[model samples]
Target: MDLYFLGTGAGLPSKRRNVTSIALRLHDERGTFWLIDCGEATQHKILSSPLSLSKLEHIFITHLHGDHIFGLPGLLGSRGFQAGEKPLVIYGPRGLEQFVETTIRLSETHLPYRLWVSVIDGGVIFDDEQMTVTCRQLNHGIPSYGYRFEEKPKRGKLRQTLLQEQGIPAGPIYGKLKEGHDVALDDGRVLRSADYLAPPTPGRVVTILGDTRPCDSAEELAEGADVLVHEATYAASEWERAQNHHHSTATDAARTAANAGVKQLVLTHVSARYDEEGEAKLLADAQAIFPATTLAHDHLIINVPRLPG
Candidate 1:
């Protein structure tokens, strides 16, 4: 699994950064991509990345803010032009369904694929065999949310060496052993899979929060996450301004990550006021509190590796 940043700026688009949008690439996990947010000109930003509109199966909108949803109509229309027929599902706040329906209806944008729009409040919005996505409301000016993506635990490794030591050769029986089933060989010998199998490998947890201030819900959603993508819309010096806007400063995001025991923190939704040098200071401020912190930029691809047993 990997994460690709399409837009990392907060509020509005800028020369250095666009609005807030993130693509959670799941090619390795499920051969599909789950978009966290689609801000203004998001499709244009995806053109610069290696992502395809056809592979975008799911889109999770944080809020109804114009900056976070202005590109939805364009993206949906372009996906149809690209000949995408796969079913698309969108999970967002109550106003999201109306927004998409109104835009597509008024603009006469015809989508070839079936679209599933769900109004999500707080809870597990999506659950499949491989993973589960949970959402929680955050302390934002509007009704914003955060999503937690967690992969299911994988089966333990097959004890090939142990099987060989026990005079068991690879064959159809090996499949049963790998599936944690008791395999009876042609020679009437029963091989127990538990003896050869190790403990189940733990799954990776990724928490991507929407625009919010320092809140307890953010910490709860990000608890023990392998990667926590939080908003850092202001520098340390702008704490008052951040609070006024119900946004978080770099240090505020870092503190939340530390409290949540997150492994890595990727800060995004940066204010356009900060240039390259200012961004460095924002990164530094977060690193001072949480060492494993990185400031995200447009088109920044992050590889989220599975944890070692």
Candidate 2:
């Protein structure tokens, strides 16, 4: 999986960055991408990237803030114009359904595809064959949330050589064995699937948080995640302002990642006040606490690698 940052600025846009939008691409695993946040001009940002509206399968909103959801209506409307007929599901806090419904109703927008809005109250919001998503409310000005995407562990490869050596002809039995099912041979022999399979491949975990203050929920959502995407809306020295605004500083984000024991920390949703020099300070502050910290830029792509078997 790969995280494509379409926008990274906080509150508003700047020459260096747009607002907060990210695309979690699962093309290799699911042939689709899940959008996280739909900040202003998100569709415009997608135009510059390789992402397509047709391939957008899900959308997750962190909060009702304009910087996080202003572009949602436009994106949804344009998806129809682009001939995107795939059903799309949106998950977000309360009022999300009303917001989308109101906008669509007022605009008289007729979506050709089906859309479902799930008002989540934390816990496991999504579970499917390939992945499970959990959410936790965070200390934000509004009902902001952090999401944890945990991919399901994959079954091991079938031991074709072992089966061939046993004179077991390859056919439907191989599929069953690969699925970890014990099979009975025609000759009255029982073959344990465990003995004919390699170790399962561990799935990757990614946590993406909304704008929030340094809080326990943030750490909980990011615990042991392969990548923790947290907002660093200010430098360490502005902790007072960050706290007052319910936003995290660079140091605060890194500390949370360290406490959570995450493999890597990614800082985004930067305040537009930061220039190139100020941005460097944010990175420095985060790296001082957590060495594996990355300052995300607009259109940046970060790979979340699966664990080795």
Candidate 3:
């Protein structure tokens, strides 16, 4: 799976970055893309990339802040213009349904496909065959949330050599065996599927948080995550301001990653006050605390490697 950062700037758009938007690409596993946030101009960002609005099947909004959800209506409307026919599921905090309904009603825009909106507090919001998505409350000004995406474990490939050594011929029976089904041969010999299969492969865990302060709940949501994408809206020197605004500083984000034992950290939602040179310092501050820290840039694509068993 891959994470595509459509916008990384905090509060407002800048010359170097847009507001806040992220796309979780799982086309290889689920044949669909999941969007995290649709900041302003998110549709324009997707226009420049290879992502298609038709393939965007799910959208998870961290909060109702304008910087996080201003572009949602436009993106949803654009999907209709683009002839998208698949159903779209949007998950967010309370008042999300009213927001979408009000926006669509005021704009008089009609969707070509079905749309499902869920305003939830915290729990397993989405669970399918390929993945399960859970949410937890965060320490933000409003009712904000952080999402944890856990991919479901997959079956291992069958060892063809081992099966052949057992005098088993490869055919539809192999397919059944790979699916963990026991089959009896014409000779009345029962074969155990597990004997021919290797160990199951563990799935990747990605935790993407919205605007938040340094809190234990945030760390719990990111525990042992393969990639923890946290918002660093302020520099290390602005600790006081960050704390007052309930936003995380660069150091705060790094500390969260360390405490959670996350493998990698991707910092996003940077304040627009920082210029190109200033961004370097913000990144360095986090990396000093956690080595696997990276600043997410607009349109940056981060491919997360699968976890080992």
Clash list (residue pairs), candidate 1: none
Off by over 4 Å in 3: none
| Regions more than 4 Å wrong, model 2 | none
Clashing residue pairs in candidate 3 are: none
lDDT of 1 at 116: 86
TM-score for candidate 3, residues paired by index? 0.97
- Candidate 2: lDDT over CA atoms? 0.95
Provide the lDDT at 268 for model 3. Answer: 97
Candidate 1 Cα errors over 4 Å, as ranges: 185-190
Which structure is stronger by lDDT: 2 or 3? Answer: 2
RMSD of every candidate to native, in Å, equals 1.4, 1.1, 1.1
Deviation from native of the Cα of residue 170 in model 1, angstroms:
1.6
Error of 3 at 31 (Å): 1.9
The stretch of ten residues in a row with the least summed lDDT in candidate 1 is 183-192
Q: Residue by residue across 1-309, what tens digits does model 1's lDDT show? A: 989999999988999999999999999888989999899899999898899998898999988899899999999999987746888999999989999999999999899999989999899999998999999999999999999999999889988888899787788878888888997767887889888787888999999999999999999999999999999999999999999999999999999999999999999999988889999999999999999999999999888888767
lDDT of 2 by residue, 1-309 (tens): 999999999998998999999999999999999999999999999999999998999999999999999999999999997756789999999999999999999999999999999999999999999999999999999999999999999988888999999898899999999988999877899999999999999989999999999999999999999999999999999999999999999999999999999999999999999999999999999999999999999989999988778
Question: Between the candidate structures 1 and 2, which one is better when assessed by lDDT?
Answer: 2
